[model samples]
Target: MTRPKSTSAHVQPTLAQLRALIAVVDAGGFGEAAAELNVSQSSLSEAVGKLEDLTGRPLLRRSARGTVPTPAGLRAVGHARSAVQAAGDVLLAAQDDSQLSGVLRVSSFRSGATYLLPPVLVAFRQQHPAVTVKLLDGDRAGAGEQLLRSGQADLALIEGVSAVDLSLTPLLMDDYLFIAPESRGTQPVTVQELAESPLLLSPRGDACFQRIETYLGRLGIDTSSATEFEQDSVTLGMVRHGLGITLMPRLALLPVPDGLVLLPLPEPLSRPLAVATLPWRARLPLIQAFTAALVASLGSASGQTTPLALPVWNQSPKLEPEARG
Candidate 1:
């Protein structure tokens, strides 16, 4: 395993250098970062060179194949971004003694922004009136994970596993409902029936939708008969409008938009809504509080347990050093 940039050297990175490094990594090359940063490639290279000297390791590999982060480079970027963010938080902490005002950036997918954010943001604003919060809905595959990893977002309310290394807090248990017009009839629909029926559902790329697809796949039913739409709201509208029947999260029914009935799933099909961030960022008060609030909100929504059961531990054989030795 490659180690991240060392902080033991006590060589402080300036804000300018931190930004330059993040930009280079995000843009995938210094030349591109220079264009985005409005600086010459030579200037960007100089900054990276200085960063390499400071960190005592090369951060990027460049060639006609384009740029790739060296093992050290990936670690350096993660640490560099974390360090820069910590510095900003420190400054904010100091400022809070006089004025408790700052920007809180958050990112999430549509379902999160729609069903999850309204109450959380409302409550957070009520508590932190001085702090300004901005929420952006993102594409699950690319932009959502990018915002968190790039240090562009303070807290990210993502679904799951865009990448493997993310440490996540289980936020809510979503009950999947098969929705149809009350006029459509009351009988429960099976996976096979829905596969062939006219289905109004969000695009395949949506996280919860993908989970439903996996469930369908598990049942060995092809989703070729499904008709894709923009989002749950629109799809729900179509269902209400009598266009087709579809699956939607139970929580997504807030306000219980009329003209439709939510049918129960034939099997247990639960999806998790989660809060995610770097594991090392676990201790920050903002992160801690945000996580607590989400879990609490989920509990309140469920009306059963305040927190989920104590997290289960893995039951596996421990690796023995003697086996390797």
Candidate 2:
């Protein structure tokens, strides 16, 4: 008589099989689950079939409404989700703790990407040669929102005044300066003094535009006649050509362009610059590593005397005047 074959060998389900069951249960259909997993429907079905065979029970009840997890499948799917997440954590731990070896997606505004992130990225890359940093540029608010809410970015560099719910760490302060033609007088420019020139301001709805308006409003300067330009390059170009003077952040004036002079605004208004990330995301080893590297880079660049502590949202430490510049 032939001996009964052993069934123990087939009991263990593969990670892919577990993932397929979870995706089908979560997504409610084979096609939707396949799309979400970036695999073909047939392949997804095959994976779930293998999982069912391993357990010797049908994991999903297919119907016109959608695929629903059976009783055993319901319990198994719950465990599978946790298992998949655990597997991911293990992989991330291996990459982050042992050797950095994955893509780190960073989002920032144009100026931050250009002037601020280069040194930080360079230093991080030197330390974690296997990790690749992908930078995505957008407006400050947009980038911060994407990074914090949408989970599209691993980290973000954004202006400090963000409305979203996120964990923000102050990196530095960027001083707002007066940009004028070289022909303008050398003395520090007052709001009233600059108001006398043809003022090239950012468009009304812009954050920078609103900031300048508030600053000038306090000085009783009428800016109704200011020419508004949408792009920074255009505003700076106009200033370069003697069309008007404009208020610009020092970060935007790195390697100040030819034919332009940067003078300190009276009383020197500055905006705080911060790194933003989700609170949960901050706990990840990769994000923590990147944040440390970034802080070190910024600290080195700014020449801070003491060790830096991460600041809470809207609460930034005062840096020395030279550091702000």
Candidate 3:
């Protein structure tokens, strides 16, 4: 028998090191990741440092803004995610099938979670009492897509179908409504009139803001002088005080605050909200169960007489999404 060539320089990384690197990248900083993972920041740093040493490459770009993964670090983190997911799958596979049980990590924007998820969650709990569902904040633009792609979340409820890479199941169509104080009357405002008015914009760097900006800009509206607010509540308060008029999706205006009136814009715009997941994960029993529950819950609420299609994981040509109610 021939002996294999002698080689000993390569050192495999421990699961802890892999997890630390992934957590830092996902959470955007060691401090944040440490807090989320309930570990000391120093220990998280140490694990990432050791991982870098073992891999023979710099894995993080640390600076004042925050820590971000280096190019090599990103590649390493991808493999790390696969390894971690595989380990999780092993545990799930070994569990008894008497009751489907596992963690389903979902990332969703605040509006969707607050207004659309409660009923769906209630149904899911009734069906799978043993499963645990964890919700992560995905309020910022692209947060949901990134979380799912990075393996941090199993499901992501995001606005719009921009994330074509994932399997998307449209849940609702939220129309953009012109919002102003009731004192402003219920008259429909045209784009030119809106531009002339003081427009209070939503928090910057979100899908809602981006869509509104693009739509208004195309219509020759100059938003340069528009004041931006960090919180939706603050924006609504300002609108109530007649500081400016604003645009908001229907869902975000749930339980419309007293003294505010919502009117349809002369030129309508709408958001197609959808639930997304990795194509393969859509077929998992836990995800499928959730999907069925979501369809049943939302479908019932919308008074849809037709049966909505439940999610089925496949890579065939995409079908036209069901008409948004």
Task: Tell me the whole-model lDDT of each prediction, alpha carbons only.
Answer: 0.70, 0.74, 0.80
Better of 1 and 2 by TM-score: 1
Off by over 4 Å in 3: 1-17, 24-54, 58-71, 90-98, 306-325
Tens digits of lDDT, candidate 3, 82-111: 888878877665555447898999899988
Model 2 residue pairs with clashes: none
Clashing pairs in 3: none
Report the C-alpha displacement of residue 113, candidate 2, in angstroms. 0.2
State which candidate has the highest lDDT: 3
- What's the distance in Å from true for residue 212, model 3? 0.8
Ranking by TM-score: 3, 1, 2
lDDT of 3 at 89: 70
Q: Per-residue lDDT of 16-130 in model 1, one digit per residue for the tens?
A: 7877888888788878899999999887888777777777777788867678778888888888887888778775645533244678777887667887777777776676678
Clashing residue pairs in all predictions, respectively, total 0, 0, 0
lDDT (Cα) of model 2: 0.74
How far out, in Å, is residue 304 in model 2? 2.4
State how far residue 260 of model 2 sits from its true place (Å). Answer: 1.5
TM-score of each: 0.69, 0.66, 0.80
